[model samples]
Each structure stands twice: as structure tokens, then as C-alpha cells.
Target: MGQGDAPERTRRALAAAFDPVFYRTVYDDIARTGSDPLRHYAGTGWREGRDPAPWFSAAAYLSRYPEAAGGDPFLHYLDRGWRQGCEPAPSAHRERFLERIGARPHAVGAGPQAAPRAPDADLPAGLGRKAARELAATGFDAAYYLSAWPDVAAAGQDPLDHFLQTGWREGRDPSPDFSAADYLEVNPDVAAAGVNPFLHWLAAGRAEGRPLRFELGFRGRIVARLTPLEERVAAAAR
Candidate 1:
């Protein structure tokens, strides 16, 4: 084959390997636009809020033939069209593209096995896996402690540890605070009452079963969201 024929051959090979379902979905567009399906998808498939089929189909294609993908298949496909003289648009989809292909941002830690659990690990046992995943994605660690020991968790010390050591002492409310340490300094009444704020919050606040206010980090900004533990439990049940 001539040097110039190699890209066309590779393109043909990729077309033969394309998923049938994906082909049918975009076939009309391909025919109408007179474009190669693989190149078309390489340019447009892995976008957020679009149909996931194109992304998944591209992933399935790579998974079926590992050699074509080399060391990093997603990146390989991402740059393939551009390398063949297509415009450089795929780079813009880097984040979503990596996500679609299940690539991790960092290598998995090989440290101690008994390392401290992520805050989401403390999620109530009743929460279903889906709900737990959603909460974790939203960074709702405070809710776990709020449901378990509102005042103590709000007070900022480890809720379980503080509860075990001090028990319920009076005047220990970490009132209207961000961290347990902060609450301790500010809430003089709780300090004088000498009660375990953790236990007190559990009995008085948690028992009432109010929705917990927590911050959610979305799209690089923090937004407030209210969540009741019972709602999560119900979602789990469903």
C-alpha cells in the first residue's frame, strides 16, 4: 500500500469494527453528511447531556479490539481524527471523554489497608448503594455526622469518639457552628452545661428527624442542599 493509503485503510478497519447499533443510530447523519462514522463519532460522541450510546459504542469498540487503542485507548481515539488532519475539537472534551471510558484521574493508592475510611463510609447502613453513591458524589459527609450526632458533628470533633469519651454533658452544645472546635470556643452555654454536645444533639436534634443542611460542590461551585436521612433510606427502599 502507498504511504497515503494507510490512513484510509485504518479508517476502513475502524468502520468494520464499529458497533452495529451505533451505526444505525448515526447512519443517516453519516450518509447525509457524507462523513465517516468513526470520524464523526470521534468528533461528537463523548459529549455530556447527549445520548450515551455513541460514547458507550465507541468504548465497546475499543474494548473489543485492545491493540487498536494502544496504551490509552480514549486518548488514542481522541487524537486519531485530529492526527489525520481533522480539526482539533476533541481536546475540548477531554474531561468527559476520560469519564466515559472509565479512566481514573490518579492511580489507586497502595498504602495501608486499614487507612481511615472516607467520610462517606460513615453513611447510614440503611442507605442504598445508589443513594450512597449520589451522596458521596455530592460530598455529603457532614450529613452522616448530622444524622448520627448533630451538635457534636457540628462541634467538629470526631462525633463517635467525642460521644464515647464525654457521654452527654450539659452546656456542651456547639451552637450554630461549622466545626466542633469552633463550636466549643463560641458556645459558652454548652461549655457551662457540661453535657456532651454530641449525645445531646443526637437525642434532641437527630431524634426530631429534621432535614440536614449540607453543601454540594457542583461544576466548581458550592451550593446548599437539604437532605433528610429518612429520605435517603426511602430511596434505598425503592
Candidate 2:
């Protein structure tokens, strides 16, 4: 194949190995931490018989965003060397598995949290904007954190504190407030807190046309929706 064709071929190969269902199973397994879902799923697949090379190669894709992949079930399979295509010795799987286990976090939820309280009407609107923008710019992965809330609460610190600690001004424009609307960007776990400043802001953002992404776990496949914030507000206002 020509050099140009090589890129397309490589992309296709990668796509085939990184199946969404497989990743979903992996994420679920990790969330459960060797729970029955993983055990039952593993029993159905010929994972052991497959070459460790592909699994490991796929894991490189997963490990690219370790935290994101932490929610999947294939992590164990990834550890077993089921990568995309990095050639490895047959015996290397055991060593890699041990290393992954040793380094993995005890739980993805434990971390420092910013401790800002609620946002009264007196608080400046600019504050929320500045904080959210900064959080977004600083590799904060706010969407993902919002999705995994409570479960991933400590990861982004207190969402309210996260909003208050920024440098925003309360201009006449009234910067948007966060709400349950924005929390839906990552997952529904965030809705656990009921109503908070972050949820309030998210609701406002939606009202003003900024929608959050909603990801659903369907039998291990991740399907997302750009849920209009307005819809969330209308629903809540009812």
C-alpha cells in the first residue's frame, strides 16, 4: 500500500478493535471493580485465546484518557495486553497486569475539593463565567466531572466552590448559573445532589442556548445527546 493508504488502513484497523460495546463492558467492570458483570462478560468472550497484542494496542487508546476509561470494563482486558497492535512478547502480559494493578488509584472519586458555598442572587454573575471558563481551560474536564458527580465529586472538588473561586465580575449581562442541566453533560450521577449553584448555572446556560452533552450507557455502548439546557429548565419549571 502507498504511504497515503497506510493512514486510512491504520485508522480502520484501530476502529475495528476499539468497539464501543467492548469498551462499555470494560468501563462497567472497572466501576464495579471485578464485579459479576465483568466476570459474566469475560466468560462469554474468547479474550484469553486472543493474542495479547490487539488488546494491549486497544488499551493504549483507552489509557490515553485513563480517567475516562476508568468507567469501562475492558480495563482488565487492557491490562492483559489487549492493545491495538504493539508487538509484545507473549509473557509480557503478566508483568504489565501487575504494574497496572499496583499503580491504579484505590478509587477514582477521592481528591481535593474547592469549598465554595452557594451562590446567592447577591453574587456577581461574572464570577460563574470566569470560574467555568478557567475550569474548562485548565484541563479540568468539567463535563466529564459533572457527568460522574458524587461518584466523581471529589475529582472536580465542590462544584459550588469551583464556581465561586473564579475571577468573574457581576456585570449587567448576568453571566449564566450552572444547574442539573450542565451536570447532564457527562452523566446523570451528578443529579444526585438535587439543586446547587452548579446545577443552577447549567440550567441558565441551557436557557440561553448552551446545551450539555448527555451520555447513556446502552448495553455497554455509549450514546450521547446534546440536551438543550432549555428543555431541562422547562421541565424543572413545571
Candidate 3:
């Protein structure tokens, strides 16, 4: 979302990182009979298109290496290529490439963590004892029953399911369907301080006390302000 030219800069950077090998293998090879050594690589499997360079803007490259332009001769060439090639392009291929490459889950980078292993459906004996004792005083409330289940709720859906089905629940209001940002295609406002249309929709829904459906989806700024209803319910139980 930054500069429109940023993506091209990034693409050139990728090309530069790989350029040293690219130039040597495709351009400077003495064994080749023709002037275009790069043409040979392109004719073979090394180059992907009419462009003489290899494709480094893909997630496959990042997935195998676990870093953006892993520190190497190839990476150095890629960085330089990104700087040189992206200057002329006005469109946003670089940012799209970054997003695609960055989306892979990894513990090391800013990416999301690898999926956690599924927890045992039955609670451990000690955890079950602790949960039972914690809820002993608050008799017959599903919300109370849920309080002892922080570990499970942190796991997300399991607790949601248990809360929905269990009787005597105190907090029954469903958390609004703010996940709709995944569905809607909307444009951003031009003003620097403009309120996002998505946030306006969420506020309008909150004012009406109507649950947001999955399609209308929230833009997240409101979601941040509204304490997750689960935390509120959990606090009330305590």
C-alpha cells in the first residue's frame, strides 16, 4: 500500500539477488557458440520467458530457503536487479509478489506460526480437577463452565462449540461476524483521516444491536477497540 513503485523495486531486487549466476551462466559462458549465453539458458530450463533472468518473485523460492533473498551471490544479484528493473514500472507487481512470498507460515519471520498440534479431546486429569473446582461455586452456568476452559478456548472452535451446545450459559450473544473482510471488495478513502467504510458498517451494526453477518465483515479497527466478548465473559465468570 505504500509507493506504487515499491513492488517493482522489490522485483528488481529479487532479480539482482540472482543476477550474478544469471549473467555468468546466460551471458558470459565461453563454451556457447553464440553471443547470447542467456539465450541458451532460456532455451534450456534456466530462464522462464523471453526475459533472460530466472523467476525469484515466487513463494516457491522463499519456501525452500526460509528468507527473503537468502544471503548469497544469487541473492545479491537479485537485490540489484530489483533496484534497476523496478524503476520504470508504474504498476504494483512487487507488493503482490511480497505478499505471496510472505504469506507462508514460519516461526522465524514475521509470518504466522505453524499450526499447533491438536489437543486431546479429553482434558488431562489434573486440568479437569482444576476446572471442576474453579466452576464449583458458580453453579449451573455454561459461561462458568467455560471459564475453566481457557486452554481450550485459546484453541478457539472447541470452546465455541461447547459454549453453543452446553446449557445454563450466561453469555449467549455470539461475537459479531467480523471475518467478512475476507469476502468484500472495497476501495480505500482518499482523505488521510477518512473513516474506513467497513468500520462505519460495524459501528452502524453495533448501534442497531444487530449481529454482523459473515458477508458484511469488519475492517479490524473496531474489532480491536471492542474487547473480545470471550474475555468479558471470562472475566465475569471470575
Report every candidate's CA lDDT.
0.40, 0.38, 0.35
Off by over 4 Å in 2: 1-36, 41-117, 120-133, 137-186, 194-238
Choose the strongest candidate by lDDT: 1
User: Each model's TM-score?
Assistant: 0.18, 0.19, 0.16
lDDT (C-alpha) at residue 50 in model 2: 23
- lDDT per residue for candidate 1 within 1-238, as digits (tens), equals 8989876765554444343333434345555666655565546643321222233333443455455443334344433532332221223233443433343233467565645654333334355445544433332244454565666756777643443344223333222332443333333233334433333333343465421321111211211343467988999999
Error of 3 at 23 (Å): 5.2
The backbone clash count of each candidate, in order, is 13, 38, 21
Could you arrange the candidates by TM-score from highest to lowest? 2, 1, 3
State the local distance difference test value for candidate 3. 0.35
Q: Model 1: how far is 57 from its true place, Å?
A: 6.2
Worst 10 residues of 1 by lDDT: 214-223
Local error of candidate 1 at residue 130 (angstroms): 55
- Model 2 per-residue lDDT tens digits across residues 1-238: 7877865754444333333323333344434655343344335432433222212432443445444343332433333223332232322343343334342233456568734656644232444555554533443344544454443355646543444443122111112333334343222222322233343344344455433432213212312343468988999999
